[model samples]
Target: MNYLARDPYAPKRLIEIGEAARGLGVTARTLRYYQDQGLIRSHRLARNVRGYDLAAIEQLKAIVALRAVGLPVAAIRAILVLRDQPDAQVRALRSALAEALREQQAQIQRLAALAEGMASDDAALPPAIAGLQAPSPESATPSKP
Candidate 1:
């Protein structure tokens, strides 16, 4: 027997678009967008409706995860193109993830600074607005070693 054929994790069945989308917690339109992007493929069954094999569903799961972290479709496509080469795939994904992490970290720092500014400006506000403000996180938390 071929090594790939004996793999336990290989998909055994296919599912329709609705079932696949619900299972993955995404809309059918999202699935179509992925299809349009050539990121995933679907089968046409009965009256031109779409169906997804388990392998496609698995790919959708990964695509959903990547998109959730704000990875661009192009980057995901670049990574997927290297799927057959695990080393290349990992390298591409690592580069994309690192770049994404830097963007998120910068955004987080900016938001934190904005919040800090808002807290500082609280004192200049009218008593009504000022009173509604919670204690700054720094003041609320006990100092750590």
Candidate 2:
């Protein structure tokens, strides 16, 4: 068995941070932040410049999508940690999505409750209060003699 054989599916060329950021529709600072948060890893090709492999870019896409849907950094990290295990990864992703859905549903319920309360309060307002309006400029100004 040739252990050194290159996988055909692997990225043939690495891309710099700027290109990766632009391709991902994110800023270089955001990529750096992801690196800092241990969410994604970048290759240090030289003294300061960083590059990313295709796998890294794919990971960034997943991160961005997860974030767009309101998944927190911690949950994203947890999902990433399960990447190596295909079965576990699916389970983890599903669990995270379920949790996010529950949270969104709860938030919607809370907002609906608040809106209903406000509606009831508006209905209960005294007629004078409900009818009150700010005086228009024309009404405020005295009529010329």
Candidate 3:
């Protein structure tokens, strides 16, 4: 279901590049880069002006979201193409999201271990940092026993 195409409120009015970028909390260059990447198309208002309709704005929103989660431009371009194919889009997105979740879970474990080590100020090197045999130059100052 292409919701952007079906939106009844989609105005004929054009949103210029700067406005769209501001609304999306991205730079104008980023929007232009997406156009260059063929992820989204914008209207050519004049020789120097670029514009986007509401549908394209929605598409840009999706692009921004996908990029936020560490997906590269090539991956985003593929996802945008898949939007035209519902079955494939769902399958691809699910696979990407599942992989992201797995990666995030592993990252959380590593960060939690680091945090635990940092939280214990008095401990003689928590297990996570126990491999080190020498303290840094900054830790040369002896600690109280």
Candidate 4:
């Protein structure tokens, strides 16, 4: 009893905002925001209602994945366009990604250096400051009047 065979005229699945949000593990508000930002598209079902078909769902997934990797919405849009013209765009996108990676690596090195410096400073703290300790719990509490 194959369901598809039984119903030859089954309509394509049109996911509503809530269902799509749940599928993506995002809030409906976030979905709406993405829609507003023009990061993803939705089929208008009515004046205030919207739905997403399979293509739209896949596009939204791509948007989420790109955003997760720190690509800005503008960059994601450009990358999406590159999908249609890969040969023409690959070099540019690769250059941009390489630049971003270099920037991130530099930031990581700066943070590591700062952390190492702080560790050394802690090791060299003045004896008076290093020897200070919190008051014992009993001493911290006031006696009853």
The best candidate in terms of TM-score = 1
Better of 3 and 4 by lDDT: 3
CA shift of 35, model 3, Å: 2.0
Task: For candidate 3, write residues 38-145 as lDDT tens digits.
Answer: 988866664547778989999899888987886667767776778779999988877777776787899999999877867866757666468767868987994321
Rank all candidate structures by their TM-score, best first, as comma-separated numbers: 1, 3, 2, 4
| Candidate 3 root-mean-square deviation in Å | 11.2
By descending lDDT, how would the candidates be arranged? 1, 2, 3, 4
Ten residues in a row with the worst lDDT in model 2?
1-10
| Cα distance off (Å), candidate 2, residue 102 | 0.8
By lDDT, is 2 or 3 better?
2
At residue 64, candidate 3 shows an lDDT of: 89
For candidate 4, report its TM-score: 0.63
lDDT of 4 by residue, 38-69 (tens): 77776654344567778888988977776665
Stretches of candidate 4 exceeding 4 Å from the true structure: 1-11, 121-145
The per-residue C-alpha lDDT of model 2 at residue 59 equals: 92
